[model samples]
Target: MKKTLLGLALSCVAGAALANDHDDRWMLSTNLIFNALDNNKNLESDFGLGLGLGKFLNENWTLDFEIDHVNVSQEGGGGSVDQIGLGLMTRYHFSPDSSLRPFLGLGAGYLDHNGSNNAQAVDSSDFMLNLSAGLRKEVTDRVSFLTEVKYRLDTDDYTGTASSYDDYLFSMGMSIALGAAQAAPAAAPIVEPAPQLDSDGDGVSDQSDRCPNTPAGMAVDMYGCHQVDGDDDNDGVKNSMDRCPDSRPGAVVDADGCEVQVVIELQGVYFDLDKATLKPESISILDAAVKTMGEHGTLVVEVAGHTDSSASESYNQALSERRAKVVYNYLVEKGVSADRMTWKGYGELSPIATNDTAEGRAKNRRTELVIQD
Candidate 1:
């Protein structure tokens, strides 16, 4: 009986340590034990039932008091014993897996043992020191099954019982978690409405209504302005909606909504090596220039040529003029008006960079296009 009470106290401590929060709590447990006597004396096996109330002091400790009852029988007769014990138990959880918790507890408790004449009883009710080792397997989130082996050191006293006893107990029980497990109040979802403006009944809002003076009956985007279609120049017919995106006030425009005026720039360079003929790559560059001049009917272009300082002055002058005329003839072949194009050559006299290095000489030999507006 002393051992059974000790085991209950230990299991309670284990439960308290495994529980989620620190709070005073109660647990009820039942165990079946096989009782044995010290000197090989035959003793009846008994069933033990225990109920414990414990307060969790912290994660690793608990204070528990338990009541236990055991009924034992011999061949002839049997009786029951009731015990009440109070203990302070400490538990160490050796692993994070809550399902299997192994712990040790050492506690001192006072036990009052009362038995009928038919049952073997200790002669005294005294203070006993208890040590227990136990394991709990969590069957569910809130409950567990516990088993323990315990030793109780009953300081011998008036009852005249042995100094100590051992108990092996197996029990099934549960623990209740305190905080997060409780039901929570429901919350309402939040909804936000779209912004409404343009409140003044004009075509604009108080904010960003820069065109508050905007006339009515015009379409608008979200910012409260006249709906702008393709107004690339912001003249407002939107290039798609505007008949002439680039037209000056009162200027004539073609059917495609573009002004008839043209502008052109002849800007690029060519290299002279081993021949006076234009290279195939230079022909492609001049083709692009010609196409640009054709797109704008009234445009005029000035083609300027430059030469490096390696040659005699007159020869370099003639070479520069030949390069300039080469581009001019290509543009004319592509149907640019001869009256609107002029070609000029500035020989090595107009060197843009030093000719001492190959790279500087390359830069000094060049062609340029100046647009005549």
Candidate 2:
């Protein structure tokens, strides 16, 4: 009678899929089951557990796999009945959009059970057909509560005497949705390597050659330019003619190859109100200094800070030192190497003008960049 009612219920809901219309795509369900074994009058009601993984094929249909384990107690108190089942199921949901969804499912499962008692009569492993109907109620967006009943028709002979075995199950459990908002797979980026060419045949790739054209059979620098045509210091004298190969750029080079010493004041690098902080206007001037350093990679420079004679020698010296350090830090931040630069503070000693006059004091308070060959 119980099997007939379950079959009828399953037929009523068979066409609809057993999933909610919401966007959740993955489901995990766990339930406690009550198993009633027919004609095993010596066995008491058993407790079981069923676990299922379900996927929504669409809003109205779901496909699932379930596994169950049960331990049936013996009324006569000698042994226990153990049963395990595995099933592949499909469900049709009747009300996917509602908070309370009703569904019916049909599946086939393999059930294996054995009684350990020496006097027990049933020990069989058989495949059976099952019918089920269930209700699911949403308790939260990602979770739902479920109640279900199922009946399995097993045709295997039990105790080597019975025609068939009737197995009924009742379950109540929870379902949780998983990975609903996972990010979609991203397309991979395509990268092609840069083309390589050696137009000058100087044993260097053209893409990396600083000087691309050179006469055939002429010795060339690493840059693929003619070695004899190279100027090491870029001071307008070729390396073959310049005696000082490291003469500083833009300097006056004598016949013997030495740069004339010249002092360059860093214009616009001025401080306000006895503070060591550099003014905003000084950034452009310093930026130019950084560019010059990059252009002449081998050039070294000294950053010197100066202050007027109005303050005490000690105070002016400390302030000037701080001012010079600030300039040094700024250049380092701009990617200049620290080893290529040095800093010094000259206080009240090297004034270019008379300290008694305001104009002279303003002129004395300045920063200077001293370049080295």
Candidate 3:
């Protein structure tokens, strides 16, 4: 037991070099445990104590190394049995930053029963896995109370016995979160604002005014002027310097009033089930993309197609390829130059959301237009 605990600590320390940036804190915990042994063990339920050394990887995740000890007395007090356990568990926390957090976990471990002192003197070692759920309630900045239950699937037979047994562990404990040992990101320096003073009283100050001799009763922009009226195109650049007078709404425009192509997620673009043909309702979104490309003559696009994991990997890959090709062909038919675009299929490899629910699956089936330099 000592050797195992030492190895676990050494392994965690050695892993620190590769994990400093993600180490949110260290979790030190202890639990009062009730172990319900399998009937095959011919043992009664017993109370135990547990110790844990864990690393919080982020707001939503933690990896814990655990050790527990329990002793059960024989029915007639003929003798007592001792059990020691060691495990490594990873947990996913929900509502991590909230005052109360809930988590679920899965882990595997080894258990040893010492029978050297018993009249039977038959020892056994076995492997086990557990499914766990728990809740943590905050008490302070560094401390929290924890309650959890685990169903352990034990494997292997007791010494000279053929039947296997499982165990249930009910635990309650407190956890202490250690401080981060790494440096944090640097903060921006604070700058005091200069005093506001205007000599002409036209709102444009003498220290910043490009034109101070503006005639009274006439409107002027920040850079006092008679010809430029704020911004006509409303594209951020002044009218006097705006080479293109009008620009599309929500478009990325350059300083000279030209559109600058950037990556875009085609939100409404979708296809029919098991088919690559574009849906009628999705045409408007594609048309908008085409219009943007036409407005920017030098703009290049990469049509990327993705899909949900409803089908086989090979089938999804081919389906995604067809979807990309269909979009590529549509743009070309609409006068987009063939040399200005490319197409690729990512299949189900890149998912933006979980696929375990219907809404998430719908979101996973998506398309994107990437701009190339």
Candidate 4:
């Protein structure tokens, strides 16, 4: 018994030596205890006082050694008995950072029975096993209120007979951690891993990121991939890549989030005086238009026809219609998608230049491919 007590006292002292600041590494506790004796023991339940020394094994585990003393009266005026216990308990505390920590405990102890003045009770001792549950509420960083209920299993018999007893113990008290709130180190601080860097400014860091060049403010998954996005305006370009996010429907776009523009023009294409036939020079420029259409399969254009003011509006309108239809038909024959092309006649009303001079009149007789979208 002396050696066991000595070892536990040394453990408590060692735990105190391992404290720093408000870490609460070691504890001193006192409890008001109530012992409920078994009915077969012929002694009434009574109150006791207990003292313990404790150590935090880690953040969530604690080791404790306690001594308790209680006086129990004999049932029929035989004399009171003194019950004392010396024990070591290991407790598991849940949710270590909370204001009120609940815990479960298991321990083993030696219970000593001492007969009082009349000597009706016999002095004996028994080994005991204990299971307990409790709560520890922090009153401050260094102090706490503790409440517990314990079940003690033992085979103790005060009278020399073939009987045994178990006990239910209730306790409530307070504990104080031993150390100054601010002090030197008893143990080294825990080391933490260095933080990983995200060079691309995406939420995911460079270490495991597959798409490290993702732009800022974009949503990404675990592997740093941009989330699947929609073409909100039905512009064929996804929102993530679209520079002009609000592009109109059917607007054709390039890979760089821009509208696919054209160097393809109908500038050199001019027609004869009163005919809808295509001039030989018109073929090259027109074929270039066909190639451009094939390159951007989504390109939609209007084949617009205009005429010089050489005739009445009614006659010029009919001539314009025939001119536009001729070019439109040629494009379809050259494999330009008909679904993406529309033909229209503006007549002399929408001429590009004045018809007052020869050069101006020639310029007014024009067929142009105007982008529709």
Candidate 1 whole-model C-alpha lDDT, 0 to 1? 0.58
Model 4's lDDT to the true fold?
0.76
Candidate 4 Cα outliers beyond 4 Å, as residue runs: 1-24, 116-121, 161-163, 183-373
Give the C-alpha miss distance for residue 36 in model 2, angstroms: 1.8
TM, every model:
0.37, 0.42, 0.50, 0.43
List the lowest-lDDT window of 10 residues for candidate 2.
15-24
Model 3: residues >4 Å from true position, as ranges? 1-29, 39-44, 52-65, 88-103, 115-122, 136-146, 155-162, 173-208, 218-222, 226-291, 294-373
- In model 2, the clashing pairs are 16-92, 16-93, 17-60, 17-61, 17-92, 17-93, 18-93
Pairs clashing within candidate 4: none
Worst 10-residue lDDT window for candidate 3 reads 13-22
What's the CA RMSD for each of the models? 32.7, 27.7, 11.4, 34.8
Top-down TM-score ranking: 3, 4, 2, 1
Candidate 3 root-mean-square deviation in Å: 11.4
Residue-level lDDT of model 1, residues 3-54, one tens digit each, is: 6766775566555555432333444344443333222112354556665555
lDDT of 4 by residue, 1-373 (tens): 4346435644543554343211235799999998998877778898899999987754556778899999888888778888889988877788754768899977777889887535554778977767789998977657889999998865576665545566899999999988864332255578996689898887777886878889888888666778687877677656666678876667666653576644234787766536688889988988888898899888789898887766568877898899999999999999988899999998889766655444566677788887877
Task: Indicate the worst ten consecutive residues by lDDT in candidate 4.
Answer: 15-24
lDDT of 3 at 329: 93
> By the lDDT metric, which is better: model 2 or model 3?
3
Model 1 misses residue 341 by how many Å? 71
